[model samples]
Target: MLKREVETAYDDPPAAETVNPQGASPYMLLCEHASNYIPTRYSGLGLDAKELQRHIAWDIGVAPIARELSRRLDAPLVLSGYSRLLIDCNRPTGVASSIPEISETTAIPGNQTLSHEERAYREAAFYWPFQREVGRILDQRQAKGTPTIVFGVHSFTPVFKGFVRPWHAGILFRKAERLGHALVDALQEPGLTVAANEPYQIRDESDYTVPVHGEARGLDAVLIEIRQDLIGDRDGQMAWVERLVPALQTVAAGALARA
Candidate 1:
């Protein structure tokens, strides 16, 4: 591949937003699919406004929950500011899904048959910066001898491909299986359904954040996926935040004890 550097200028919002950067908590929250904003330059990726608002553009309600959880837990949170349709922050760069031509059933007209310059521009403009910011924070914490656990917050559609999903929430992990299982067990309740790695699983080709930033550094990490229908509103988001803050705290404590 020829190396081409594109000079990216931001007219919309920033590529990433970090909150509570000074927080002392061991947990670091990441919302990779936080926003559904396509830069005006992209012209909504050749889709209507309605399509951009759909779950394909972003995780439906993960951003608010992540913010509230960060506030409640006093952990630093990092959020990507562009639509996943532009370039999925959680997916590996140069992959098919990184800049998906088709998300779900909707075809992205703007993403079709791009030149190398276009692909590199999107990665340079929107993708790499977000990943670099997360890495910088992790580096700072590691340098300070602070123990850190990476938590990726996401939400899934209640129904996917005409099949109804019964999981209220899911915890996804690969190498950090122990932490993933602990969180899955911690989230169990009398009637609430929590599954271990459902809807989607993390892989090198399909994911970037957990594998590159968390597992590569040998830090405990997990991705939490809530059903979108459950967290589509403020009340639901707050409720999940309340439920998750404690569960995450308990799990972190247990991990520390074992460490």
Candidate 2:
């Protein structure tokens, strides 16, 4: 293997960046598909500029919202800096989607064949630093006996496989029912659409953020997914943020009380 076949440096932008690491709120946020940046060595993963901009590359318009939420909610947020094509921060290590060869319908040529060292390099450089930061934050909260509600912010394309999704947003949870249901109900207003566990669900086998950092520690964890089309621009991102900030603030007390 050539010396440049795999990741060897931190690059210009690190694999992950954290905001408000010492935030006071119990709400800890994670944006796994926050960026679509592919290191120069990957060479766009054999993709054109257009495909790299697609949802398969990253969760469109989520990083900004998560950043704002970290501010408005006074919560600490962990954002992965690289593209999901390199390795998905939210996914468990070695899963199919973690380093997807085919995301949605588009094939990732650079990911087609990877060696043990290459895979290991990506995990060390792209994955662990993010997950460990999350774990460290959670551990601090646990030791301090501080209340915590783990939330992962994500986005999905409005259409997949020729089917259109109806809900504008979905709150996914496995054990944090009280907090998750409260959010789903709150987002349900006169004209808005919200559901429980739509788009995706949390599975220990596939998911890492909530399952390991939240649930494993007995903390209430939930995954909040918004429609990518709804948050594709600045205005759309703010609207959803205005909607979610209040909902999260409202249910937080009850969730923490239960915990």
Candidate 3:
């Protein structure tokens, strides 16, 4: 059974509906899997401690990098507060992976056989509102004739099953070829293997970043995937941000110059 309650240890900063007081910057950062927090409401969907620790539950090392990147760039960030186990912010709300009945090979007692109403509640409560906030930010920027660059940050496990992912970072995108290419080129560091859409590809199936935000608005966008092991600690996360921030600024500045 799923129980909803409050977790004092995990306090949500504010509702997604609330805009950042500093206003939006030309660069907008998004971290879909920021927190592995399960609202006391669902008691973590019966996941074990280890499962919560897995990359499937959250993007390890991504939250800190996203936060640091936002601070360093003075950009407003939109992040999901719940664990992907409850409802994946990256996947479309209607997809099975969005609210997984089974994740990391463990069956979730609460997510199993979720009724239409229950699914809708989660979608409306968590998914839609979060997305609406992004849309609001974009609309405001557009109205002001300020072009914006959308960057989604994510982290993947170094080893999945028996296979090891070798790249330090990867980029995912569909038609924003110029923007994507520039970013990869700028991030070319010694011994750093940068994959251009290697591990994951941006397609129609990609909901949050490519669909509703990028393609929908015809904005220059890219999704960056960092190796989890490289960014699991504070030192590692900062190092990545230091490397990525400059590349991003260069790409954004180049794009704006063309426009």
Candidate 4:
């Protein structure tokens, strides 16, 4: 099984040039829950067709939107290829929440109890590389004397349990940065309620991106979450790309200006 050929289970190395290169400045964008692919290696983890489609597997619409946004903004994007069920790429390998057995009401069969070796295998194969790559990108950019502002892009399900998340978009940040706050202000859509880390808060125990890349390095970073329904389709994705480009561009510019 170690050498198994599963397309969705493994992540291909990023291209020599970043997939999406945006702006002349050093700001980078990332979408950790960007893909739903299961790397055919796991055979859907003994799940039914419907089970694989749940939010437990991936954050719907995030990959494509992130790709489009990267292309539109010319920003480098480090996206994960495996489903979160295999092992959440954004989480630390030792964290229980890294590979959740129960996500909302859905049960992930492949994630049931197993040997310590099994856990370590998933961590080594999928989780570490994804994170290390992000770290490497940041390091290289910083070494060039470029200020890095990491943007974490993710999408959430519209209806969870019974209650609905009302905000169209929301921003999560542990430390206040001038650029992040300005982005929230610029993204004030008429019907959209932009939450400043509502629904969830950023803490060291659970968050991987902020602690590892942002807070640890003292670089400006903001975790941006968009409701999945909005970007679930091609048209909606384009609309979001357009809506967010100027604001992100302005925010990127603001980061440069601050330095």
In terms of lDDT, the best-performing candidate is: 1
Candidate 3 achieves a global lDDT of 0.78
Q: What is the lDDT of residue 126 in candidate 2?
A: 82
TM-score of each: 0.96, 0.95, 0.90, 0.89
* Root-mean-square deviation (CA) per prediction: 2.1, 2.3, 3.3, 3.1
> In candidate 2, what residue range of length 10 has the lowest lDDT sum?
1-10
Off by over 4 Å in 1: 1-11
lDDT of 2 at 100: 92
User: Using alpha carbons, what is the TM-score of model 2?
Assistant: 0.95
Candidate 3 matches the true fold with a TM-score of 0.90
* lDDT ranking, high to low: 1, 2, 3, 4
The alpha-carbon deviation from the true structure for residue 193 of candidate 1, after best TM-score superposition, in angstroms, is: 0.7
- Model 1, 1-259: lDDT tens digits are 3243333344677889999987888899999999999867678989999988899999998999999988989999999999999999999888889999999888999999998888887888788889999999999999998989999999999888899999999999998888899999999998899999897898888988789889999898899999999999999999998889899999999988898
Q: Local distance difference test, per candidate?
A: 0.90, 0.87, 0.78, 0.75
Question: Which residue segments of model 4 deviate by more than 4 Å?
Answer: 1-23
Residue pair clashes in candidate 4 = 8-39, 9-39, 21-74, 21-75, 22-73, 22-74, 22-75
Stretches off by above 4 angstroms in model 2 are 1-11
Predicted structure with the largest TM-score when compared to the true one: 1
Q: Which ten residues in a row have the lowest lDDT in candidate 4?
A: 8-17
Candidate 1 clash pair list: none
On the 0 to 100 scale, the lDDT of residue 238 in model 3 is 91
